[model samples]
Target: MSALRTTGLRAATGVAASALALAAFAVAPASAADTTQASVQGQSQQTAAKTQQAKKQRVFKVRTEKQLRMAVRKANKTSGKDRIVLLRSIKFATGKNSKGGAGRGDLDVRGSLVVMGRGKSINAKGVDRVFDVRTGSRLVIKRLRLRNGAPAETESGGLIRSRGDVQVRKSSLLESTVTGAGASGGAVMNDGGMLRIVESRVRRNSSERAGGGIEASGGTTVIARSRLTGNTTGAVPGNGGALHLTGTGSVKVKGSLVANNTAGAEGGGLWNSATGDFTVERTTIRDNTAAGAEADQGGGGLYNDGGVLTVRASNIETNSATGAAGSGGGVLNNLGTLALSTTEVQGNSAPRAGGGIEANGGTTTVVASTIEGNSTGAAPGNGGGLHLTGAGKVTVDTTKVLANTAVEGGGLWNAAAGTMTITGSTISGNTASGAAADQGGGGVYSDGTTSITSTTIDANKATGAAGSGGGALNNLGSLAISGSAITNNAANRAGGGIEANVGSTKVMLTTLQGNNAGTAPGNGGGLHLTGAGKVEVGQSKVHDNTAVEGGGLWNSATGTMTVTDTHLRGNVATGAAADQGGGAIYDDGGALTVSGSTIENNKATGAAGSGGGVLSLGGTLELNGTNLNGNSAPRAGGAIEVNAGTADLADVNAVDNATGAAPGNGGALHITGAGTVTWANGRIAGNSATNEGGGLWNSATGTLTATGITFEANTAPEGPDAYNDGGVMTVNGAVILPGSGI
Candidate 1:
């Protein structure tokens, strides 16, 4: 009091003296002590003392609950260089009767707050959120346990709620529940901003509407190397129990594990609607299930509707959906583009169609993926491995379609008006059993136009009590096979290798061998052509196949067959007997033409039967430069037997063949109809019989010609018996032999 009073009095007196001096110097009148000047001098002195005190830098420690809150708030509003509020081992609690209540307490900070302790628990008695960030503020939550803050049933509580950008890295959000009617993001919610979570664990989080673990509406979200496990929604059953992204939001998940996430509807792992782009790379979607109490639910691992789904180097296994008609046990693509590369879709089963992958109205490109051991259980569905029903183009290249079972097209079934092109792939070991009388196509069944090139259709079996053909493939429409192999396939009734009936089917350079058309009463062991069916074989091999009549090929009454430069050898027709010949070839009631070909070493080993090498009944036999040799028959015509047909042989040879019973009764060539036999420039030599006419026996009122013909070394066992005539020439013909011998 003594020093302060003296300084005030001295300072006032000095100001008065200076004013009087200025009055005297300028010859002015004195003014009433200049009271405004004296008052300004006192204020200036007091402001100087306060500025000196503030520069001392005070250190305020926060130990009590109220002091900690005031320190955090003071640091938030300050704008200095190092505005930091330090809190060490402080115990804070919000009471139930407080102003903001226990549930409404938060440590709001706009600046830095260093909280250093391990056993510190800030209990907000019952609040909706522990930390809330306002707009245009950045929040970095690091190494903090942001758990349930309240026990109030009315308000849903979570760890962090932000309207701006929130980055939570190396943090754990545990045991938090959001329990409101339209509440989402039980643990963390990013309303309309970007959220990045890396190396974090989000577990035991619950939501009511959607996104039990984390939900992002219309922003970019990135989750990398995080574990989202055992998260759930409330009683209403939410979608994407781990992560639900909707409303045009894009999410890029890399190297994350989303396991044990359950939903009431679609997308047990991740659900995407509203045209969102979701990319999952090197991730695992496992042990997730969708109950599907809602309508039209799908995707046990991922449910994508009208979005782009790219699964690369990922494993989507052991996921299930229990809806009424759920599809795609691994993935369901309804109206989007699905591109899968180097992925495994295995051990999946569907109730409707496409056990591994189902595409209804989208374009699916599968490259270098394995679709194996999948099934559609007795649902009258198609394509156990993949089903394409709607009108879309599916291109499958270098994919393994193995061990898949279906009701139709065991490996692939394409119905409706869709187009499926399969090249350089194998469709093997697949099965299709029909319910009623017709189960067609064991490996692949197409009701549309299917063009198969350079593929193998092998080891497939179709078993129907009334099934017709094609153990490996069945086509009710147009089917073109070029440079493909259809071998080692068996059917129940007919067309053991391939059944092409009543359709515009063309097979070129396709080998049909080792095919059996069962033991039933149909034709065509290698191929069955009937009902205005046309088959043309050029430079193809149809050998070692078995059927009733046409062993190598079965042609019905209305079936037309043209074979050029083709070999039909070692085919058998063991119906009741071998009398129905054509071991090498059989021509039913149709027009047959053999030109520039050979039908040899075929046997009709039936008793008193004919037509061993070539059998032509009720059809025209035109042989031009054709050789029918080394064929044997117990009856007549070892090389050829023509009944009710015309035999036109030009430069043809029938040699080293045996036929008939006795002398003059059996010959190498026997013509028994009102047919004309013309041998222009060929040899019928070395043909033997027990009777006469070792070369030929024409007895059914037919005209024979032997111009430029030679018959030599033909032996009749009962020779010189007067009936044995013309070893050089025995003919009921206008015989004109240039050179001949006996």
Candidate 2:
């Protein structure tokens, strides 16, 4: 060949290689794409010429084990793709064993060969492996069965061991095993080679190490339209009962089923090592188990260890991780990147955290997926649907996490070092039920930095006696939520919609409605803050919530709460004690500031209920540009109350408040028991009391100071506009209605 002609040919080959490299990612699994390309390109010229000369393919017929062995020996000397047709079943004896070469323990093929079994079988007779394909060779088996090979003390592969390219079509590999230390691949092992299993079945295979059915390393492995079932691995701290992959390779599984596989350690169905890439599409992995003896071994269906694993349009269900502290009943990703698209993960269980999935480190993305019906079946279990921890970053978009159960964080959990971003998702029908007082988060729990947007959280329950946060909880971290809905959730104690405990929480453009915290001493039917937890609410709605105290919101002793441009309406407080009612807001010894907000149509029922709209119980209450209207109470302080606390009102409106009981007092504003009320630029109008002090009432130990305040349309039998029972009431720039005076 001329030099110019050779250069042209090399250019053409480069173009073809580029095209093939691009096609590999789209057409095959990441692991199996380039497996045989290099071998095909590196073929010797003599081998190519011989392949051309044997284009018709020399055929050898074999009906017995001796004839088959003879044909293999003859074919090894030839340099072409020859065919050996099996006319009948052949059972190999234990005597035909060799460490190397064709005349020894295993049938070793050193040339390109094809075995056409024609639906026949090759039984190993409890001896060695069936075939050994050497390097730089190719072997293809079709319509055959390889069974009952017990390879003792071998490195891997009970049925076949290949160092070249091997393909099995429409075949079965059954009852094969590889035992002892460092052994793997009970059926097939490909070392630095390419393997393809198409339209096949691999069943009842066992391995002592990894890959009870198949193991591929340093190359590509592809499995399509096949089934792997009833396989087991006694991998003392091993992985992959069905398929194991490692060493910078890629494995693709499409249109297949992996079921009923059991692993002694991780990955009952499939395992991907740190340098490998694994992808599953249009497949099912079900009824797999990882029953390891150690605490950190899990991933009943699939495990990705520092690898890139992608699952699309697949189902992983009915898997169990039943070990001490074992997690990720369906999938476990340890320091790896995992992506799930349009997949379903359901009916999985774990003894500890992450009943469905656990992302311990690295990044995990779930898009258009469903995770449901999973549980953690032990005390102190958490994250029934998904758990993210240890600096892991997770993103959930347009996914659903539902019907999962745990002692804490029934739907999902994010630990202190994790970060989660959720958008356009739904978390519902989950339960957090435990006897511990502080264990509760029915929909989600985050002790990390979390952001939720355009999500829905409803119909979740915290059913324990002291449970809280039916919708979501943020403890010891920062949580920001916007454009979400939290409704129809119930908590046995407090925070039917959301709870912030020792954390920073912000809610914007959200709706919280129809939630109930109805148990006795229940607080904050819509939101609760305790123990120095700071909260901010803007442009949100809190409505139709029921609680014993703070029907809409409760701010505990040491927290700071700020509300702006929000609405609190249709809330109810059913407690009968004077210290237990705040229909819209209760500042229980906390600094609460409300600005540009609306508090309306809230009620405090029961005989002793007080403060239908706002209550300051030994706390600082500051209001600016806020409206409190149409609030009713049966006892005292129909709109605003101060109980040994300080209230500062600026540009506020209190209107149409009523005390319906016969001896009710202060229909709009009340101060009692060493309380002080300072009103600046506010209006109190259309308020009615059944007895005395229709608009303002001050007790003996209380002090009322007013500037630029107006009281209008107040009606009562005595002290209609202002009443001071041995209390100091200093008024400047105050206007009284035509019917009453102070």
Candidate 3:
């Protein structure tokens, strides 16, 4: 039991008066008063008598390493638990040629051994095990320095190996080297035992195989308020520069700094691989690296395989991996369950994948943490900050993924049938560049199923030589986007804002605004859906978006688009000799329905363009309570142009539309196909044209009907010689108007 725990127990036991007195005695410094001096004199006389009796019984102090070892061996051989072995400031010299040759020099302690430094140092040379404790012994090392001054090639085992419980408090382990063909802990190694280390420092340590600083296998180790830094693994394929844990062990680390540690293979700072559980709280893992030749593996800061790794209130930053296929510059979770809360992973770089975290065949959950400013360099990486692959499940709640860059997915990349759910989080300002000919996603690329709810996807850029979409979020599987905003995203090619390909996706109650798809020969400005997928957008707004063909939304072949209560407005298409059509919306070969929407103030200006507001090439458009107004087209259909499609307009209004052309015809609506255009209980008024047909121009043998509506104040060219027509009636419209036209 710890003294702090004992104090807490005594305080909890209702000895309040005695506990308060002890607290006052422990807190206040001893002062000399006349009455207190008399009481202190009386206590000093009793303490002198007890000291004389204690000196007469047995007072043995071991000062040398050989003397300390002999005393511990004698205590283990002769005495029981009642004996006390005292080691005070014992200098143990350890090297290849010092004291004796490197063998197992064990000091087994069966009784209680108190190795006290008393603000002094202890040097050990060529000592394999400074102290070994049996199952019933209690070894306490306080305020001691176990220094191992050996060459890099020599083999030095742990300073202390304990099978029983070991308590190391306020100690420092320095200048230790575990050479080639040997695994050494600079301070101690606990196998099937319990080790408690508090306020200790483990520095300048090197190991050949594993655990350069401390190795604990099949034990329970608790390290609090300690520092493990400047440790390295010297041999090839070595791991765990600062600490290593294997077997069925459990380790808890709190308020410690694990930094500047280097490993040859994996886990530059800490590694846990064997059926154990590691819990790290309020710890900092930074500035660590793993550099070698053959298969230098994951986690520049920490790596865990087949373990339960839980980290809370920690910081993992400025770590790196330098192998060919290095993963998880900060943390790597392979077949482990890693749960992190209130942690920060920033400024980490990986050569291969997952600059911040890489999880393969594991479960990772991050809540209220931040994974930002991480980068993966010129490699075929998947995710810049987080990579979730191999059937892993990643859940992020209220976390932030920002300013991370990768080749495939800038913020988060999910492949190989993994599941990622981001709720109330943000994925912003991430960049992805294509290496050769492949396109990358700016914010997120999900090759599997991904769900995002109540999140924000903004300001992400995907740029390269063959870069198509700057803000391209490519989805190959099921993508469900609800209650989110995708705004200010840029792309170089088609589907600038978003491209949903070969997926079953739905965007509901979302907003897509102010996105620019760069000048490329493609369609779908705000969103493009293709490859036999289905997209349903409900109660959303897609406005102020621009593309070459489709300004607000563009639908390609083979998809179902159902939009309700949406708005598509203030979009422009500008390109030289561009096939600029559908300033607000364009549907190529899909089933599109626009109901209760306002698609207005859109311009599609080009040499021979059409459909300033909406263009439906080959789809079924059912418009209900929609307003398509103030739209301008240079060629035809100031508000809408339909070719090879059926448009059913009910309770719709197409007003204040203009068409500018040498031989302008359609002002509000144009139907030039074998399609049917029916206007039931609607109005097409205040529309202007340069030539004729202020309301509509139906030319390609289509049926046009207007019932229970008015075409009032619609003006053509104002002159008898200017071919002005259709003040109240346009071309071939059956109107039932009760009032006269203006």
Candidate number with greatest TM-score: 2
On the 0 to 100 scale, the lDDT of residue 156 in model 2 is 87
- Model 1 clash count equals 11
> On residues 289-398, what C-alpha lDDT tens digit does candidate 2 reach at each position?
98864545689999898899999999999898888888889998888999999999999988888889988878899999999999987635888998886899999899
Q: Which candidate number would show the highest lDDT if scored against the true structure?
A: 2
Q: Write the per-residue lDDT of candidate 1 for residues 426-465, one digit (tens) a residue.
A: 6667666653324556666666666676777776656665
How far residue 649's Cα lies from its native spot in candidate 3, in Å, is: 3.4
Ranking according to lDDT, highest score first = 2, 3, 1
RMSD of each: 14.0, 10.0, 9.6
For model 3, residues 365-391, the per-residue Cα lDDT tens digits are 999999999888666776888988688
Candidate 2 residue 216 Cα shift, in angstroms, is 1.7
Q: Which segments of candidate 1 are over 4 A away from where they belong?
A: 1-218, 226-247, 256-265, 271-274, 287-297, 464-472, 520-524, 529-539, 543-574, 577-742
TM-score preference between candidates 2 and 3, better one = 2
